[model samples]
Target: MRILASLQVRLPPSRLFAPTCPTRLKSFKPLFTSPNSDLPLDGDDDPDMTDPVKLAFARAEAYKRQKLQAQSQKLEASLSGNGGSNAALENPSSSANQGSRASQVSAPKGKPPEAEIIVGDPTKFENIRRRGEEPEKDDGETEAYRPKVKTWGVFPRPMNISKTYGGGKVIRPGDILETKEDKEAKEQRSRELVTAYKSKMGLDVDPKLIAECQKSLKDGNELMDRGRLNQALPFFEKVMKDMVFESELHGRAALQWSICLDSLQRSSEAKVMYKKLQNHPNPDVNTKARHFTFSFEAMEFMKVKSSYLSRTTGYEMYFDSFVDNKEAYTSAKTETKEAGETQILPYVVFLVSPLFVILLIAVRKSFML
Candidate 1:
């Protein structure tokens, strides 16, 4: 009651002379509001009056603004020692009010944005190379599918590839970087097919070898005809390796192997096998091997045997195709390095110039001494 009396009695004399009417009390405005607030003064003048939700929002906002203004005045009064001493107070709410005043962003002007239709190919923005949706047979997959690969912790582990993604194969380069071992394994497997196969030349002295070779050859031939070069090549190779080199059957196996190799784009390996056929005991095999290896005579020979031989399309055969690019590339690289080494002017300028200058200095000093 004393505080209320003090507040009322503290009113200025100018405001005491003013008439205290019921209408004035009903339409009373705050002495001050937050500078940033755009709160509606009159309910009827509010633009959001049409929308009940927006009208409620505006009224709530106005109420909040009035409440904040009252609080700010209380805070000022406390600071000015009119209220209890709160000089050490954090005044977090006062700071927040200041922040709110500072954070007032200007309302955006003009019309609201409309959706625009994109022109031209939508595929230009797409990188979707997957042909079909990935088969999601996760139930069939093992619970823990750790790859059979050795990886250092310091180096990225192959298993770190996130399994969180939808089904699609992730190509990790760390899994495929073994150039030497992979090549050795591939070569070993290819050679193993040749040694392990039997009966390919047909009617071997050993019955078991004969059966194996014949089966291998048949399987290989069938696979080759069906466009399975990789599967077929092994059978032909096994048969060729099992049979005696001098035998006509062996030469036939070589011919088939070479033909298959040509189809498989392994013409270099095929040429090596074709070259060995030059030492074949059978005269027909010898001539055909030479014809296959010798590009000059192959066209004319191909013309004569075009009816049957024309079946293998894009079949390439060259005597020099027997020689791989490795040897030639190494030689050329060596020659270039040697040529570069012989031209030492740049090296002399960079390395020997200081030495030469030092030598001349020493000579001049020696003569002066």
Candidate 2:
């Protein structure tokens, strides 16, 4: 028993509170060792210990440290007024505030962009004269000097009325001064009247032919009123050739024929017909035909005049030279007045003559007794 106890003491304590073997324990060391150990803990300290994730983290930390150092150097330089590059670097807090303000400015709620205004020199566009600038004079063209005439008094000088009428000195209020147009119109009318008279005596047109021509002219006029110029042209042209020039129907047919020719673009033929109609014996026909000879633009002006005159004055006279025959127009009024006077005279005579005859009979009976 003594020998077995000694051998057990000599043998190492049971592996409960101590390692099994010193050499084995040293061989199977922990992954993390003492802090003072020379072996690298991170993979960056040892180039041979390559770990992708750890190497990336180590590189990022180094880059961040370098960037901070550079930013601090820049800030110090700006504060010292040595570097003109980075003004914001001198005050980072204010720069951050300005950046936020810029972001807000870019984000407009719902407003349109402002309109850009452009200012330029007006003198570059046009030649403008200044107030104090002198006007340029024309070369070799001096203004003509006119002598002022003397005036005796403020009242106007009297015109010699006798000098105008062969020194007769007779002034008439109702006398009308004839214009060139009026004189020409009167001469044309006289010539037309003479031609009409000669035509009536020379041409022995049958009454039946005149009646048929008048009927044709009336039908043509009705077609023209309905805007059927094409259909009316043939009828008007036929009547214009067959009708006697002295007849009133001839003037009407000639005027309608010229109007159709104008509408059809036969301007040359229309001009000839209008020239002939200008000297028509009928006043109404001559005036209407003369208006057709005017320029198209002038005719439009006359149309406005005619409308105004027709409204204001119950008569439709376009030209100032055209005059209506007042004697013919007043014939009916004169006849009515004469008829009334004759009727009164007849009643007066019937009443007085009986009295006269009775007195005469009484005188004769006294003489016989």
Candidate 3:
């Protein structure tokens, strides 16, 4: 029973756990002998007993060591100026259990993870948006409500306005104009154009004849331009009669004479001229006739008498009556004034003559008595 008591036994301790093994201690090394041979058995020794007070002291020491380690770490972080424990320091009353809240609260202290504000390229963004997106809202205006643009049409209303041309001169129909400086200058130019035409015809033309033809042609051209082809006909005929040979001038004169004759309502004369021109050697006669065919036709149409001739005759008679009435009124006014004077004369003569007779009779009576 004594040997049994010498066996190694492990005891539970109220103290802190120790890293040293009690059974492996050097002082307990000789206890490995058998207990029946008067030696302690390896299992017969009792392990060290742990006291509650020692366990409490060890726990206190451990807490102190942990606190020093934490302080050192905090001191290192603070030396680096890294805002160590700033969240807890700034808001000490905040709950430590809420880690997400702590991180959020601590975010402002540290350099916020390089918030690179990336502003996209304006041109690139504009191109992308313009390609696909609808345009920005307009300020409440529809395209149809916009003012219409006015445009001039092909056949706009004819303007009755008279505008000045060739300086400030006012132009009118049938105004005889001489653009030349003097009568000499006019005659000189006329002689030149006539002489040039005569030379082209290979005819020995007289200067006086050329001058007369030139004058006729000039007057005819002016009258024709004013649409007085009836008045222009005699002048053009005289020019054609003076031309000895059928030339370009002869062709022009024939064509113009035909036109003037048509305007004068001399259709028989005009058709004769046209027949002669149709067989003329010069091509200009045919060309001029072709181009002016419509003009010649229009002149013929103008010759047709309108049905309003009787109405116009009545208006003329009414105008004559109005003139006669004015003359009759003047005669009646003279007669009325003469009659008034005659009536006044008779009254005056009767008043004076009776007085004169009474005075004469009275005088005679007085003498006789």
The lDDT values for all models are: 0.64, 0.64, 0.61
Off by over 4 Å in 3: 1-202, 291-369
Models sorted by lDDT, best on top = 1, 2, 3
The sequence of per-residue lDDT tens digits that candidate 1 reaches over residues 28-64 is 2453546654444443252323555655665666566
1-369: candidate 2 lDDT, tens digit per residue: 878767743565453332111111111122223574322233224334354565556545544555454445555455457773565655466445445544554465787865644369765745544455664543533443222344554332324435444475455897756668989998999999987776784345777887788889989999998989889998987887887665678888988888877776676687787778778778888888778777544756767323122336634556333665433356788999999998899899998999999999999999999
Model 3 residue 252 distance off true place after TM-score fit, in angstroms: 2.0
Candidate 3 lDDT, 225-269, residue by residue in tens: 999887887888787887754655567777888877766667667
Q: Candidate 1: where is the Cα deviation over 4 Å?
A: 1-204, 296-369
Given candidate 3, what's the lDDT at residue 309?
33
Count of backbone collisions in candidate 1:
7
lDDT of 1 at 117: 61
Quote the positional error of residue 188 for candidate 1 in Å. 43
lDDT score, candidate 2, position 261: 71
The RMSD (Cα, Å) of candidate 1 is 29.7
